[model samples]
Target: MLTIDTCSSADVDRLLGLADQFLDDWAEDAVQGGKPDEDYEQRSTEWKVIRPLLVSAPTMFKGLKEIARIRQSSSDPVAICCAALARTALDGFLIAEGT
Candidate 1:
């Protein structure tokens, strides 16, 4: 991961912007009912895009631990769980990719 001292201002700005957009979109999805194909595509794209960014994030370790905890608590066939575990794993991958 690149330290703050090594990262350019533009990189930080871009990361923050992407994070903000992701959060906003996620929030919007929370209110919807059935999932759309585009939602899956967007999430996949997000995973691909953010994985590398997370490597440089300041809170990567904390985020990873949280993901681990969620995964550990998950039962078999993970999909049977409330989707929380899947979300957590997705989050972890995203962070790791960033690195």
Candidate 2:
């Protein structure tokens, strides 16, 4: 449910690439219980590798807003806009976790 207000097609591509990479890393970590660098304390604290992804959330939210506006002419504009907004909010946490 992630959307981005990308300035250009290149930004959209970059965002998707980053998302894919994050999912791959998360899947691998899940299979392994966690990353190799995860010590007891580190595991208990915040995950450091995901910091960059966290910073990208606002851009993604803006993107979703743009998408909702673009689709506003649909039969169910409210539903569509609400869905887009929901996706934007979820993307905040998902991107934060790099998932």
Identify the candidate with maximal lDDT.
1
- What's the C-alpha lDDT at position 16 in model 2? 58
For every model shown, the clashing-pair count is: 8, 2
The pairs that clash in candidate 2 are 4-63, 5-63
lDDT of each: 0.60, 0.59
Task: Give one digit per residue, the lDDT tens place, for model 1 in 59-97.
Answer: 554454565566666675653463565456556656766
Residue 63 lDDT, candidate 2, scale 0-100: 61
Assess candidate 2 and give its TM-score to the true structure.
0.33
Any idea what lDDT model 1 has? 0.60
**Tens digits of per-residue lDDT for model 2, 1-22:** 4333334455655765776686
Query: Model 2 Cα displacement at 21 (Å)?
Result: 26
Clashing pairs in 1: 51-97, 51-98, 52-97, 52-98, 53-98, 54-98, 55-98, 55-99
Winning model by TM-score? 2
Error of 1 at 51 (Å): 19
